[model samples]
Target: MWAMVTLDGLTVTYRDRPTLHGVSGSFAPGSLTAVVGPNGAGKSTLLKSILSLLPIAQGSLQVHTPRSRIAYLPQQSAIDRSFPITVHDCVLLGAWQAAGALGGLSNAVLDEADAALHTVGLCGFAQRPISALSAGQFQRVLFARLLLQDADLILLDEPFNAIDSKTTAELLALVADWHARQRTVIAVLHDHSQVHQHFPQTLLLARGVVAWGDTAEVLTPQHLGQARLLGESWDDHLHAA
Candidate 1:
């Protein structure tokens, strides 16, 4: 398998305190990886570091995407809630990387955005103001934007938290389609059962990598116990093995 993202001895800090410690992993293309860990385990930190959104405190991380290779759905909390951008404009921004700094979007880019909105079942809301969207709808808009980006590696933070069941299903289906097309997916998931059901690979973390491999291997009872000990327990039985 082709490694789309690799982390070696990755460490991060916030306010002088370490968040991630000596983490190492290689994310392969055409595979879905669920990043599961207790709160404060640095799942979001890891993703941000890989995207270069946050400064790396130590270690090394690399994302290998061919030109237009990476797309990201940041934590909902990070989004500007009061921003006045419309859904269509938000999705259109996905093509900005391809458009470069000086170029305007082409008709093809708009078409791609439309297709992405349709895929996320949000086509009709294209003209709606972003602030008018519910949390779930907002996430859908981000997904639409990701589709427009046509990236090889996709990273999502807490994707199914507030979405309706239908939207959740659609997102999973879309992710599966991306995997089928040889893209890599890394999602920070809260639901252990859902992680096991939907993602073949799992990364169990607690300030560092507790274990990473097949879901069955990483989500074992021993690791769950450790995670729970760290007060990160949420449905420990769901991932017990």
Candidate 2:
């Protein structure tokens, strides 16, 4: 598989405090990679750095996608539910950025947005207001937006944080389909069990790279312990079992 996004010796800081330090990794096409760590582990920061949402203090980061080649699905908490927007409108917003000045949305863009909603099993609620959606349903709307982006790389931050089992399963299946279609997925996940169950590759971060390898191997007790106590004792578990 081709490398879609590559980061070498990447570093990021907030308020002069380093959040990501000397992180390096590569994401390939048709791959599902998970970023796992405890709170304040720089999981979200890493994704932001990749999306260029945050500036990199050092190191090199390369993205192979075109304008819409990479899409983002922010965490539910990041979304403002009070916004008076319909599900259809929200989904259509994905294409608005790419829309031409021909007035209304193009047929192709509308079709794609409809398909995205359908893919997430929210076709029936397309006209419903986003504020009326449940936590899981709201997430599906975001996923639909991701689908509408038609990007080869999708970045999701804690996508499964507060959803029910059924919705989580549905979202995972959608991600699997994208993977099958040769799209690359990078998600920040807190649930270790979900990482073990769904993602094959894992990037464990702790203001730095704790481990970056196969999910089963890197997410061991030592790494967990080190991640749990990142600022104080990452070296202790740097090479520990």
Candidate 3:
């Protein structure tokens, strides 16, 4: 059984500066893992490295899953809702690998898109402009797109940030469904209680890995404290230099 993702001494850089340093870990296929850390801990950077959206400055990062079979939902703040795209078109973009640009969507693909919208409980939102959506509703639209992709490996960056409780619960159910169906799900999250309640595995990082393994074992107070200290020390060093 091959791992879904593996990183060996992985160091990633952005804008000519290193963001993640010598981090190494592998996520087992079909596991649901939460990545937690304090601000500036490289949580999102890890996901970006997996998606090949950033440069690996040192060591190796591998995704055993094919590129096309991978799906990513970046932080909502990264999205430009001002773009003039409708909800239906935005969700359909998930099938881009299957339905090429300018290639018409097959009936089956169309059905899947519609079903994905329904799954996200945005039944009548297909025609709505994304600019008009609330933050929670926009997040739902992103999840609907992921559903359409049917990805084998899913990476979500801060999936539930700034959303209402009801919306969070609904999206979390979708994540659980993906796990039950044997999809590999790695999410960057900050809510410790949510991570404890829903995720079975945890990766606590601060520029480097503090701990990674069973959720209970890795998120202990000592490990959490170490991560905090590491983050603060890194900040202090940056300031000193």
* Model 3 / residue 192 / CA error / Å: 0.5
Candidate 2 weakest ten by summed lDDT: 232-241
Q: lDDT tens digits, residues 36-91, model 3?
A: 99898899999988988888889999999899999999998998899999999999
- lDDT for model 1 comes to 0.86
lDDT of each candidate versus the true structure: 0.86, 0.86, 0.93
Better of 2 and 3 by lDDT: 3
Candidate 1, TM-score vs. the true structure? 0.91
lDDT over C-alpha atoms for residue 209 of model 3? 90
Off by over 4 Å in 1: 231-241
TM-score of each: 0.91, 0.91, 0.97
Candidate 2 residue-wise lDDT, 134-190, digit = tens: 999999999898878878788999898888999999999998888888888999988
Model 1 Cα lDDT, one tens digit per residue, 8-119: 9998889877788899989987879999887778889888888887888888988877546888888888889688889999999998888989999888888888888888
Off by over 4 Å in 3: 15-17
Clashes of each: 0, 0, 0
Candidates ranked, most accurate by TM-score first = 3, 2, 1
